[model samples]
Target: MLKPSTLNNKLRVLLIEDDTIEVMKLKRAIAKLEMPHEIVEAKNGEEALDILRNRDSLPDLILLDLNMPRINGLEFLKILKNDEVMRFLPVVILTTSSNRKDMLECYKEGVAGYILKPLKYDDYVEKISTTLNYWSSNELIKG
Candidate 1:
């Protein structure tokens, strides 16, 4: 169950990750942090795209993973950036890849942020908490 937003600003986050463990970790982190944001999960980029295309109300932010089967994160980002409506949606890359090239490409494609998954669980939780807090405070465009 999700807690009520104490900050009076809740966010709907679309998490595009292929690893089940990673997905569970994020959920656990949110719960531990006592954040009231809603999480919408997608196993991969393709699934995420489908969800985005069919949803009535779009998510406030997208937490994307770079490596996945089918359409990779970069490919998905390209497609999303080309879309008229979805292009404005903030996409934050959350992945283990620290490749400078990948980072540059993501920035070139206009990602809101790029975060490396920390080795320590505590560090991961901290990063997630900080990222969510920042986005929650931002004035997001409601589609």
Candidate 2:
């Protein structure tokens, strides 16, 4: 069992995004949040899955993009949901897709949250910060 304070301090975040520009924007937004987080970047779902499998400590949360080359977000979510160890970790769909079907499917597949990426830089910062703050303060799991 992981301690609450330890989990708070080492809140690992995995962002699976392919767009270089979006990645840069998100990185800056995350930096401005001023939280003690270890951010890991994955260009696509395959790489993210590889890291999740190989790493000893899995990320506390995953910010997943819906579309990408190789394995897409839905496919990756299916695989992760089926895995007993990984299923417990919260997966948030942070993508540009505003498709209703995609959003519905993501929820059906057990995504913890679905956030459409804000087009503006300032909004992006605020949204990310609020989301992270909420998750950090909440008692997600009990030891």
Candidate 3:
């Protein structure tokens, strides 16, 4: 467990994923990194839109899963990019799909980055840790 005194800045990350197990894995990975980040979750794109619209402050970044129950990641990306307030927000796709079509589409829709999930836990942790580190070091626009 991380002591509050030792913790640094908490970067808010909106995680839009439908699978409960995948969400848990991601949480574990972030925790292992000890990155001092906060995660807000949504099961699907519609839910994510609602959360974004209702909240006063926006997150530093969004971690999106392409294969979701409703409105999927691509649709979510489109909606987010179209919105005036959320258009500038960074969105990174974390997904199992490695399809070239999907990758091109996400880039077309304005995703900041696209990450393919590794099958192994250790690899996943490593990937997540690196991503967190990079984002933490970079400056994000104030919401």
Candidate 4:
């Protein structure tokens, strides 16, 4: 498990999701962790791209959902991974998609990790906590 002390700086997370309930669940899971991480949200990949383009800085990590109204996760991943500036930013797939193709594609495109959102609340919390712990302990490309 990763200790908060292991990470001297607060994590900056960008959540790209379209479902309101799922977003709430993710926020709840994050709150349960009690880590001092900052989260920014985008409803879809298009909005996420716009946010990335307009912002002067990028988030340390990006939590992406596979399904959305515009510019689905795979497409977004392609765009992000191809960019010289954004390619270094770590991206994690946090979606319910269990597609083998999706999994393979994300890995090929350079996702830090691929996590399927659990059906139960406790399971969800555990998954989120473990993921954060691992990422928090490991050194990122940004470092």
Best by lDDT: 1
Which residue runs of candidate 4 sit more than 4 Å off their true CA positions? 1-8, 141-143
For candidate 1, lDDT tens digit of each residue in 8-91?
478889999999999999999998988888999999888998999965768999999999999999999999999999999999
Residue by residue across 59-137, what tens digits does model 4's lDDT show? 8889999998879999999999999899988899999999999999999999989999888888888887777666666
Name every residue pair that clashes in candidate 2: none
Between candidates 1 and 2, name the one with more favorable TM-score: 1
TM-score on alpha carbons, each prediction: 0.93, 0.89, 0.90, 0.90
Residue-pair clashes per prediction, in order, are 0, 0, 0, 0
Q: Give the per-residue Cα lDDT of candidate 1 at 101.
A: 100
TM-score of 2: 0.89
Candidate 2 per-residue lDDT, tens place, 9-93, comes to 4467899999998888877776666567678999998899889997586887899999999999999999999999999889999
lDDT, each prediction: 0.90, 0.83, 0.85, 0.85
> What number of backbone clashes does candidate 2 have, counting pairs of residues 3 or more apart or in separate chains?
0
- Name the weakest run of 10 consecutive residues (lDDT summed) in model 3: 1-10
lDDT of 3 at 96: 94
Worst 10 residues of 4 by lDDT: 1-10
